[model samples]
Target: MNIVVCIKQVPDSTQVKVDPKTGTLIRAGVPSILNPYDHYALERALEIKAKTGAKITVLSMGPAQAIAVIRLALALGADRGILLSDRAFAGSDTWATSYALAQAIKKIGPADLIICGQMAIDGDTAQTGPGIAYHLDIPQITFCTEVDSDGTKVLVKKLIDGGHQMMEASLPALITTTMPHDYKAKYPSFLAAFHAQDKQTETWTAADVNADLAKLGLEGSPTRVGRIFPPPAREKGEIYSGSPAELATKIVEILKKENLIK
Candidate 1:
């Protein structure tokens, strides 16, 4: 089986900074890390590779600097890395971004399975994976917590509100994984790191992927960011200090005063 894993390079929340003028992230100086959710997807992909001896490819779309995340995937056990970077792909929302990625995967040719994280930290929209599946015209399973293989078919345990549902899909499908999908990701050894650093990743631009110029970047995005600002600060809590009965009366009084309870 040939497995394609999609990953993203996101700003480390601890070091995030915004561009005041553009109302966008200032990615140049911020420390970048692999999206935490993507790690579980990568781990699951590697586990599948280990069990079936399948070839694994890591794919990502971002600025040129995003290559670091791809190399990290290589160090973790991916056989190859593909970086989709270009001026045309800048400022793409989830829909356009997934469109571009789907084009790149088409350029990479056939694959048995595609894997991705449940969502990206930066956007957290959880739309890209399904968007890619839509673009690829393939069946998809989202929020998968467990995956099993029966040689020809893939069985996935999907997480729902109360429990998990098991479903089987044929090969050449896309899957988005969530927490505890597999064992914790392993640390890369020195040798793997060194080799990953030396590896030459395939780089593709919008043109290389045959993406339409009009539908490749911000131009293709239907949604626009009207404003970007931090959320309002939370108000201090009111504490009721007394016996249970008194506290209950005080809570009710406060709730009634706020018109929250009848």
Candidate 2:
């Protein structure tokens, strides 16, 4: 079986800042980490590989710095890696980004399965994976928390708004994973990391992927960021501890005072 996992390098959100002038992230000097959800997705793929002897290929797109995440994936037992890096890919929105990745996947050859995180923390717009499915004309399942396969069909546990559902799909399908609430990402050991450095990794450009030049970057993006600003700071809240009746009365009075209720 051949499995491909799509991963991303993202700024540590807690330490990231937005540039007000450009409406862009201030990536300068911001430490990057593998997108946490992608970590879980990779772990799941590795587990499957162990059972089926599948070859796992880690695929990602970003600046050269993104190579770090690919190396991490290889160290953690991925068979190899592919990094899609090109100046033409900068500022690509979900649509263009997915198009580029779908093109690369075609070049890499057909995959029995393709996996991706439900969303990237940096963008939080869970559209890329589904967009890739659209571009490739493949069926996909999103928000999957678990997956199992028997080489021809895949079974998955998928999350929904109120609960989750079990689903099955045929081979050559795509799935997007959602990490468990308590999921803790794993790192590679020293020896494993050293060995991973010797593993194969290819860097591809838009032209190499045969991507249309007009749809490779910001110009191809339909969504434009007008501006980005932090939400207004919230004021402290007053806490009242009392019996239910007393609390209810106090809440009513406060709501009436604030004209929130009649």
Best by TM-score: 2
Q: Clashing residue pairs, candidate 2? A: none
lDDT by residue (tens digit), candidate 1, 1-262: 8888999999997777767677787778788999987878888888888888988889999888899889999999899999998999988989999999999889888978999999998878999999999999999999998776544778899999999899999988999999873456667999989987876799998989999988867789999987665555699987668899999999899899999999
lDDT of 2 by residue, 116-221 (tens): 9999998899999999999999899999999988779889999999999999999899999998898889999999999998998899999889999788789989
Q: Which clashing pairs does model 1 show?
A: none
Where model 1 places Cα greater than 4 Å from the true spot, the runs are 181-185, 234-262
TM-score of 1: 0.87
Q: Estimate the Cα RMSD of every predicted model relative to the unseen true structure.
A: 2.8, 2.5
